[model samples]
Target: MTLAVTGGAGFIGSNFILYMREKYPDLRIISIDCLTYASNRFVIDKLSCDANFRFSKTDICDRNEIYRLFEEEKPDILVNFAAESHVDRSIDGSEQFLRTNVLGTGVLLDACLRYGIKRFHQISTDEVYGDLPLEGDDPPFTESSPLNPGNPYSASKAAADLLVLSYSRTHGLPITVSRSVNNYGPLQHGEKFIPTVINSVLRGKNIPVYGNGKNVRGWLYVRDHCAAVDLILKNGREGEIYNVGATDYLQNIELAELICDRMRASRDLITFVSDRPGHDRRYDIDCTRLKTDTGWSPETAFSAGIEKTIEYYK
Candidate 1:
């Protein structure tokens, strides 16, 4: 089977590609990435040495290149991980996010239609459900939750999800979506929350916290997320949206403190910063549907995951 993984040079995408390769030694895996700033060329370079793996530095928004590659490779499955995912960058300018996340997804869908892919999996985030109150019994977002994107980044992703579903309904495409919470592990971009904390501790620099640092977010180990996606690809029902998440969650301040303690650094390293506009107070998600459907559950505890992440950065 030929599998095309977009944004395969990025953090999560690279990890997923490595997971797939290890599990399916004979499978032909193609890493498709546009080599954005967040991309890891070292990972791509290492994977390219594998006989069953191929790399394409191609953008998903480029219809011609995507179509050409689709026609030539005729991939059996295409998993989209491509997007301008940074919320801060999205707030600064939404046009690039729209072009890459929305229009790029459309272009991929068109290619999937023309080239006839067996399955098209979309990698999405729980942020699409917007924010919950910092404290309350508010129910976590389910697969049926209405999309209420709080930022341009999530809005773009939500739009892509809707577009994918529309194609499935209108054109009979086999597609599935997974909305997951924050993922942390090896190869994460330095600008991301966890990595920033680790890097700050290692460099003896202050760890910046947004607002009063009360925002809550669920955390999932990247490998667990990759495993869930693999299961969805193998056994997930078509035209279904699955919520993949773990119970591990922490407020921004708490998370920073935990990392400092774990690293044996001073808590004084943490500094509060002004919050971004429309910052979500919290994000919670329910993965009961995914567990019921595929018997998938998170394996790594937050403590273990954080330790591994810190070691990687060290």
Candidate 2:
């Protein structure tokens, strides 16, 4: 099967590409990326010799460029991972986020419709559901949860998701959406929480903690996410949404402490800073649908995953 994956040079996308390359050698894969600040150039270097893999430096927002590549490649499946994903960056300037996440998604959807692709999978974030109370009796968000995005980044994602669903209903486009929780592993950009802490510890710099650092986040290892997506690609029904996440919910302070403890650094190195605007107090999602339907579950424990990530950064 021929698959086209946008933003394959980014963290989760790169991990997915690597996982697929190793698991399915005969799968013809086309990875297109615009080389944004978050893109990892080194990840695609390893695929240089694989006859089945092709890398294209193209943006999903560029209709002509995406259409040209689609015409040439004629891929059966398109997995869109290309997006301006950083919340902090989006808060600073929202134009790029809207352009890439909303408009770019429209461009891709148009191409997928015109090309008559079998499936168009959109990789998404659980933040589109906004936050749950830090101290609450409310159940974790499920696939049926309402879209109540808080930040520009999430708003853009939510907009794209609505567009995807509209196309599925109105145009009969085959589509699947996977909304995942916080991803932590190797090749994640240095700006993310885990990598930022790792980099700070290595450089002997104080790790900045936002507010009281008690915001909870459900962490999913990147490889596990990749496997889940693979399962969804193979078995997920079209016009459906799947939530992918691990049960390891840790507060920001607790996560920071664990990293410091693992690296033999002092907890005093963590400095409390002002919280970012619209920071979600907690992020937890229910993956029961994915687990029951696809027989998929997270394989890596948080402790083991964090250890691997620490070793990678070291």
Candidate 3:
């Protein structure tokens, strides 16, 4: 199938591209990206010789440009992985997030309607459901959870998800949404938690932890996330939202400790810093629907994934 993937050069997107190429050798892929600071051009450098791959350097918010490409490629599927994903950056400057995540998503949806694309897949984060209660017996976030985004990044994404659903209903567009947990793997930007901690430890610097480092997060390996997306796009029911995550949950300090242990570094390097505003104490997603429907589950165990991540950084 011919597919148009936005943000294809970014961390998770790059892995997904590589996965698709290996899994479906002849499938044609059109990659649309702005090459933002977080985008890793090197990831797709090796794909240049493949006849099935094409990279277009353009903003997703550019409706005219996106429409031009859509008309040319006549893609069957459009998976939107584009957005300002970092919470800190969003907090510092939220306008760009809104433009890219909210407005840009609107543009893509409009294009799908105009072009009559078969499927539109939105890559979203579990943060849109806000944080789970850290100290209680609260259950994980299901697809039915009310969106309570605590930061600008998640707020914009939440708005985008709404727009996607609206188009699915009003315009008769086939749309699917996948909200996944924290993704940690190769090509991740240094500003994220795992990368930041790794870099600091490797450089013999203090490992900074936010808010006593007790905040918890559910982790998913990038490859596993990529696999889930493929299954969802292939078999997922339209207008359905699926949560993607393994049950692995780790507190900030626990994660730091894991990294330190992997690096053979000292926990003494761990340092607590002021927490960001609206820091979610915990995040967990109930992906039972995805598992039950598609028989998709995370393959990489935390220890194995963490080791691979460290090796990639080293």
Whichever of 1 and 3 has more lDDT, that candidate is 1
Which stretch of 10 consecutive residues in model 2 shows the poorest summed lDDT? Answer: 41-50
lDDT of 3 at 147: 99
What is the model-wide C-alpha lDDT for candidate 3?
A: 0.92
> Taking the tens digit of each residue's C-alpha lDDT, what string does model 2 give over 1-314?
89999989999999999999889989999999999999997757998888899999999999999999999999999999999999999999999999999999999999999988999999999999999999978898999999999999999999999999999999999999999999999999999999999899999999998999999999999999999999998999899999997759999999999999999999889999999999999988999999988899999999999999999999
Residue 233 miss distance in model 1 (angstroms):
0.5
lDDT (10s digit) by residue, model 1, range 1-314: 99999999999999999899889989999889999998998667887578888899899999999999998899999999998989999999999999999999999999999989999999999999999998789998999989999999999999999999999999999999999999999998999999999999999999999999999999999999999999999989999999988658899999999999999999999999999899999998989889988989889988898999999999
Candidate 2, residue 44: lDDT: 72
Residue by residue across 109-174, what tens digits does model 3's lDDT show?
A: 998888888899999999999997779989888999999999999999999999999998898899
Model 1 scores a C-alpha lDDT of: 0.94
lDDT of every predicted structure (CA atoms) = 0.94, 0.93, 0.92
Candidate 1 residue runs with Cα over 4 Å from true position: none
Model 3 TM? 0.98
What order do candidates take by lDDT, descending? 1, 2, 3
- Per-model TM values vs. the true structure: 0.99, 0.99, 0.98
Model 2 steric clash total: 0
